[model samples]
Target: MISGPLDHFRSGYVAIVGLPNVGKSTLLNRLLSTHLAAVAPRPQTTRHRILGILNGPGFQAVFLDTPGLLQPKYALQQQMKRQIDLALKDADLVMLVLDASRPDPDRGQVPPMLSGRKVLAVLNKVDLVRDKSSLLSEVDRLNKEGAAEVFMVSALRGGGVEQLKAGVAALLPEGQAFYPPDAVADRPEKFFAAEFVREAVFNLYGEEIPYSTAVVVDEFKERPGRKDYILVTIYIERESQKAILIGRGGMAMKRAGSMARRQIEAFLGRPVYLELRVKVAEAWRNDIRFIRENVYGSDRPSGTA
Candidate 1:
């Protein structure tokens, strides 16, 4: 998958699709060498299709980070699934990342989204698999099932990533760059601001709450040569859950805010003043109006992004 000498620019979208907890975000981050997508050790942490762009000499890989395909329980989950489908429809190439460390899928069974489109099966987290021979066999099995290629890589340990990158680049269609070479992502600062806070919530909170929660950046203002101030609201469904997020003496909320703010500052390349507040939305996941207001608004902000 090496580039040729009489080089031409290769730029196209590559969709990263997989089941839950398969390190799709981590893989995209490693590929781009940037924390453009939020990474957490929780299932379905990515709620929308996030784009992480990798621009190199003669190439720009716009890797789309899609939510894990799963059964929908609420309107929000349905939207997430729709995002995945849309990504598949638009991608020039598809990287189907599967957790090599996890329990094997039943023989002859396949992921539902394997229906149409050209895909490269990537066996991710290979470092976690103890039996190397078994892992190779699994990869070979996937290659037989319509994948144009199969790659084994550890997204965390940086194992076999170069090969994966080259494979992805080779699969992309020949075209002009969709975005500028310097652009790492298409998302605005506020989107990452909310996602960074959500990542902290996933890391700190227990089951159900993290999945139920969503963050909205209410206000973001910056003064030249001065610090930035950002106000964000953490949304949940129940009052008790809101109390849990706040914790005793606001300790939990403070910790989450502090951790997220540090990451935000690093991302912004300046000091940041972050303010977080929690509110109960009473089944926002099921409410289409609420989804239209907060989740949809935050995810698809107007203008170029």
Candidate 2:
């Protein structure tokens, strides 16, 4: 969608809602043509609502990419659930993204929170489905499940994304753009720094290390005629986790920092000097106060964030 001087603009908030690890981040990146959301090979990689604005010719789609819906396992997970709920509350339409490569017994049922809003069931990863007959059957089944429409697309390869975006645009109410014409997102650069670092950790670590970590950007400075300086802290629940994350002589942390800095630089359209550190937050997943204070950057800080 191209943006020109618009006299009839269609704009609305579309919440990307789905189960854990359903490629919601990939779908968001595909829709916006930018890496506004973090992607990893794990559930719950997205913990916050990522708002990505797509300005087409006569439509402005404000996508609220939300945390996956799941049963809360701890305080941090509960907070994540709340973030998803808040996204649902503000959404004018909900796009239920699903992995077509996997079996979903609950595909027909919409969550209670989405009862009133319009829903569009998107069967992603269709490229992985070998049987064309089965894929069509699945679409027919989902269409019967009460979604306004069912779209088949491969978010990884950019297939069928244009049609889905068009379908989404046509449903929106006609109005002026919510954000500026040139704005891609409504967040500070520091926020995305933490997100890229978290994505790096999730990709590099394994065995509980990824889920046990929380990244917080302590200081972000933009220096003229110099690379951007970013100071980030990775909060873990135990000392053993910290040791694993840092590796021997800090090799693991160094690797993660280098990888994250490259991605951050690419996204920011400049150079970056990323410094990574680790701290033990001691069962922060279960500690509500600790999760709220450090993870969300609230008023309270016990020095671990």
Candidate 3:
């Protein structure tokens, strides 16, 4: 159980896990009241664990937003899945976010993998449902899954968030504040830039294009007065993929850059001049070198930044 002053305590990590498109990113953003994580309408929009920090007078809670759970399609995917594994290793709490608007065949079932952890089943998107009784029944069903607690919340509307925050704070183990009271997140600036670019790609393109692509920020430099300058390369698996990203007279690229720049500016709270270049890495997702150099590079982006 949490150990610290009732109103002034510091804390540990909480892992938010769920299926793709279940509103994990939305929840994180609301909790932090900041755009620390990129939000896209696409499934698997989050490909890495982004940290969102909550600071109080005497407490701090660090939340880790993990990629959606799915079967690995390549080495990159397998690596992404590993982020969830790492989160489960020593988490102070695990939040299993399930969509209440949809039925889960495994709804009431708890995997043995979580047998020893403190688990909370969050029935998300409650506002989307028409009947509260049915939602309650679903909650009851999940209660049988070994979750220590249950919370029905609509991440989009900020419903029940205060209660959820209070509950989470109550569960924190006693310790010095893990981070400064004002720290909203732990990620480097470049990571957000990369994610912003990727989110743009996801929204601009349909189907395999979003999933098949990756973005790496090669340069992020401070400019005199115009704006913060960013240069990023969009990596794709094949040359044919390159054409799709570039488009005729670079219309597609222009759309992606423009869309992404707005979000980047919002996230950074400054004008951003985002420059994007498309390249073909020839199946980088499956190539070890590609994954090593890009996805899991030594300067790997982490919320713990």
Which candidate comes out best when scored by TM-score?
Answer: 1
* All candidates: CA RMSD (Å): 2.1, 4.0, 2.6
lDDT at position 238, candidate 1: 94
Clash totals, every prediction: 0, 0, 4
- Residues 1-305, model 1: lDDT tens digits: 55443156677788898888899999998998777778888898998788878876567888889999789988999988988877777688888888888785642224656756688888888898888788766766776777888888999988999888777777777778888777888788999999999999998899789978989999999978878999999999998897889999999999999999988988888899999988999988999888878886855542223
Candidates' lDDT values, in order? 0.83, 0.84, 0.81
Off by over 4 Å in 3: 1-10, 298-305
Q: Which segments of model 2 are wrong by more than 4 Å?
A: 1-7, 298-305
Give the lowest summed-lDDT range of ten residues in model 1: 104-113
What's the residue-level lDDT of 287 in candidate 2?
A: 87
Displacement of residue 210 (Cα, Å) in model 2 is 0.9
Candidates sorted on lDDT, descending: 2, 1, 3
lDDT of 3 by residue, 180-274 (tens): 77778767788888988898888889878998898899999998867888999999888888888899999999999998898888888899888
**Clashing residue pairs in candidate 3, if any?**
2-172, 3-174, 9-58, 9-59
